[model samples]
Target chain A: MSSWRKLAVAAIAAACIPAALGFAADKGPLRLGTTPTAAQVEGWAIAVRPDGQGLPAGSGSVKDGDELYANVCASCHGTFGEGVGRYPRIAGEGKLTGDRPEQTVQTYWPYATTLFDYINRAMPFPSPHVLPPDQVYAVTAYVLNLNSLVDDDFVADRNTLPKVKMPNREGFNWIDPRPDTHDAACMSNCRPAADVKVSQTAEGKTLTPRTTGPLDTAMPQ
Target chain B: MAEQPKEQLRTAPSSDRRRLLRTGMGAGVAAFAVAASGRARADDPSPPADPDWSQSLGPGIGDRVYGNPSHFEKDVIRRNVPWLTANAESSISFTPLQYQQGIITPSSVFFERYHAGRPTVDPAQHRLMVHGMVDRPLLFTMDDIKRFPSESRIHFIECPANGGMEWRAPQLNSLQYTHGMIGCAEWTGVKLSTIFAQTGLKPGAKWVLAEGADGAHMARSIPLDKMLDDVLLVYAQNGEALRPEQGYPVRLVVPGWQGNVNIKWIRRLQIGDEPWYTREETSKYTELMADGKARGFTWPIYAKSVITFPCPEMPAKGPGIYEIRGLAWSGLGKVKQVDVSLDGGINWTTARLHGPILPKALTKFTMEWRWDGSPALLQSRAMDETGFVQPTLTELRAVRGTNAIYNNNSIQTWQVKPDGSVFNVQLA
Candidate 1:
């Protein structure tokens, strides 16, 4: 073959090799094809933010909420939301800090809208959505009243629901100390020689040390 | 001795000799002799032997169309907390993994965690509504869903918080309680993409909110990219209508995602431009890290494997040769390999994986070990197709901190004592 022709063929082969490899890499992992349209994806969006971004438009009164709560929620949630067994108690509980603290709506929940959104979406035990929008509003009002967050006559419609501030609203904070550090306290200082007297095991039986000699070899003379 | 008796018999009458010999024997021998003589007196007699119970019962019928687990498994049933939540209206139950063998948790024995108890929905009346960011909003009936081309894949559905009890301390005694919240089944359903194709997708659609028909109206927002990737509107599990506990008429089978996102008793699919901050996506499934920052939208369950046998409850019968068996799974992809460590994490031996190692399915793995009855900590680690290795407890804690109660797929260790007692232990 001619030298020029050979050179051309080799150059062409080199170019084709990379293109073939790129195609194979692009094929990548076996994946399911895309089918869901962008519009169909939007209908199910229902997240509510602490800043009230996704709060729906609705309202209810604390008095009506109390009546709805008695009929639907009191059975399992206890008369005053003390909770029974696995069901969480939602009222009259303080911050879940200190010893023997209770985690309830009054103590733990950061946003009042969370209760409204949760109850509206999944509440009242059996036959969900059996209650209309107004009843859900009333139930939220009643739950808030039970928690002592709102007055008995306060209305809890969507507009008023977001306005009701929870006691533990400032309880949760975004405190991410990136790159954590742990240091041994013994590294810096040691007790005085007279104060560092070793004690023998009880009954004059000494425990076998897991390691030989002193734990730290470096010491100030 | 026999010759002297014969000579005496000859000296006396034959009948008298015989009586004398019988009297010389003990009373018991004489009674046996009498019985023998009586039997001899009869015309014919048969030898005695044990009776056959099967012959009396007769041969059993053969060949059944559908089979149940052995009659011995009558005690194995899905048990629920009677008053843990609500009565039948809303409740949760657990699968009896202690009584189960092999990796596949029977559909009947599969655990159920329902916000509202199981809902009884007629298949005919069941409708799946798909609306939102789409060119056309379409509602599909059960029959309409069946008309589409269906794909059957063996996948595992696991609750993200399966090991929630062990987040702070080793609270559960058995692996069944700590890791029983998972089950594998051959799911047959139409791909969510196929349905998505029917309604042309809009440009900005990024998420899909799935809702259930149960009393809780359980809902979760799934990323649109994930739905387009590998999601199924599963109608059948293990070749039958999903067990009532799973999802009777239909359920969204999100492969490798948390069990909660696989919405059971599904009735709606709303597509949107952004995540619908549903209670499930924000308040419930969110993980509050030790750093105080909540980790939200953490969907994919990482690679996790556990040694089921020789666990805390079921210890090794004795030292000798034994089979160390367990299950390994990855929600992100297929489980590539599982390595078993006998001496904490010092030395790892590859376990023999069995069955089809399908993507997002529970792959059963086993290994043979000769226990010397010495104190040892055993654990298993899994690697997935994406090159992600199962992290150790310390490694996981280093990243996510100690406060989160979700996605804890760290290697679990079981400490075995000389007296055949196994206890849950953490590797230092």
Candidate 2:
């Protein structure tokens, strides 16, 4: 018999042997785990991409989102999404290139679906992934509305979320234009003496929080 | 060790006895012994009932269920700047770089960054589900994952926000705060390709979504090319099961990449044709460029180095002849060379790099400097095997501005004063 014919016969036998047996054939020496069903896959795969992929069937209006935001998010993220304490500010617009850029869903986020995705996955600060899909859409809509990206009564569903154009949609690219800064390994006399200056000092700054005791207090003095 | 305050020394019981002895014997052997004992008493609060620990019967085996660092090494610890974040649960802590001796960071002092807090996961209950665009979907338990062929490699895991605090200005006043958001470890795990081979990939599968089992379910989409390259499904670090904060049950170790992509408490990996553009990729880790345009998927950490000795926390005593030591690492490959500068960027000298320079791991570098107690600016620059030289703070800010807030691997400068105190400084 030809070599190709023998390989085809072996392939047929390999496929038939699995059907002949009652279980799925092991690919390696260790028959490690069971094959998961589609239902099991859906239960754990919850990430929603920029193209609205993996979104569950749900919808929420901006009015409902405002109410939800007040109850669950207002403490950490302020009533106006100004952000309290170290929580991120979620509502701002048009200062991406400024000295103090107020990066928010409106100003810096490249896609609207990210708001929905982030809210669905991790939100409410104290609790995460507790809100149902509808509330996630509503909260996303409310945050966007605060930045004037959507109407107060705007409804966000899978179809509408992706279609809603974000202000910075065209602002991002995947190209890495790095190795951007270059410093030569010059041994001596690399630059003129007059060009050097100490631009900043952290003299009186209190950066780290004071711990209860010094880290080295337990060590020998 | 810091010097004891004069007030503290005066109040100490041993010092009181020593003062009496010195008064009795004005200037002689008794006075010298009293002074020597005073210094020793200051270091050890307890009076020496016995000579030393070697003579005493220390606790035998199994006295400690798990071993700990010696009592004298209590200063080596993971420290956090509490005000940097909203709360402890969603914050970052730095490695004690000044105290670390070699390339591999001890499991205890490794820096930690978490979106949510570290989860206490039971290994037996943990399961990793692999599905989507595969010939067969598989759900493997932790025990089953260990059955696969395994390999051990030493690599560095660094947060792109390592030197981010210095972007706006020289804000943090210590080397640990400036360059300690990183740690190197000997990771033991099964190669990602081994798992991929078992669950055969379908045609057109190009991306893999790695999702963690933490509260945030932290997720990132890694390209298939990277998965096939050097990524490992790690279960152990530094010869022991991973610590809870380091992703105990299981984690993905993406060698040579930034830390965020190496998701901890990893539970699911879904193969797909396109990237998942997760929230981390879009809102958090993306580098905001100077021209209002943001750059996504800026994954690899560049070459970076910083002088650990004579830093803000470990200033020189008198500065005669001291060996300046530091760590240099590169994601692309092993570090080729490191240059030490005593007078800012005007002059540089090649530092001697220590042995066992593994790829993608921290390489130790040292240089002997003779200081005349003069005020000087000290800096260290690293060059990776790729011939990529580390950049200066001025050079980096010229291109990236102060807003990127991530991937700041610029050379750090420490200003040494005439009094031998070192301060974190930014020179332009």
Least lDDT summed over 10 consecutive residues: which range in candidate 1 chain B?
A: B50-59
lDDT (Cα atoms) of all candidates against the true structure: 0.68, 0.81
Per-residue lDDT of model 2, residues B123-206, tens digit only: 989999998888878999998899887889999999998988788888878778888899999999988867776686777777
Off by over 4 Å in 2: A1-30, A208-221, B1-39, B42-55
Contacts from the true interface found in each model, as a fraction, amount to 0.12, 0.58
> What pairs collide in candidate 2?
none
Window of ten residues with lowest summed lDDT in model 2 chain A: A15-24
All candidates: DockQ:
0.08, 0.32
The candidate maximizing TM-score is 2
lDDT of 1 by residue, B1-428 (tens): 56465455433334633564455533443444344343322343653232222112222334346667854456555543232233545544556555656656788778788777778989988778787777667777788888777899888888887876565556555566667788888899988767776665676777788889777778887777677666899888888888888898899998888899999999888778765556576556766655444666667777889987787657887788888888999876788888887766666788899977888888888999899899777889888776667776676777776666778888888877787777666654
Candidate 2 lDDT, A39-122, residue by residue in tens: 888888887877888888999999989889999998988999899877888886557776777788888888888788777777
Q: Which has the greatest lDDT?
A: 2
Q: How do the predictions measure up, each by TM-score?
A: 0.72, 0.87
Worst 10 residues of 1 chain A by lDDT: A201-210
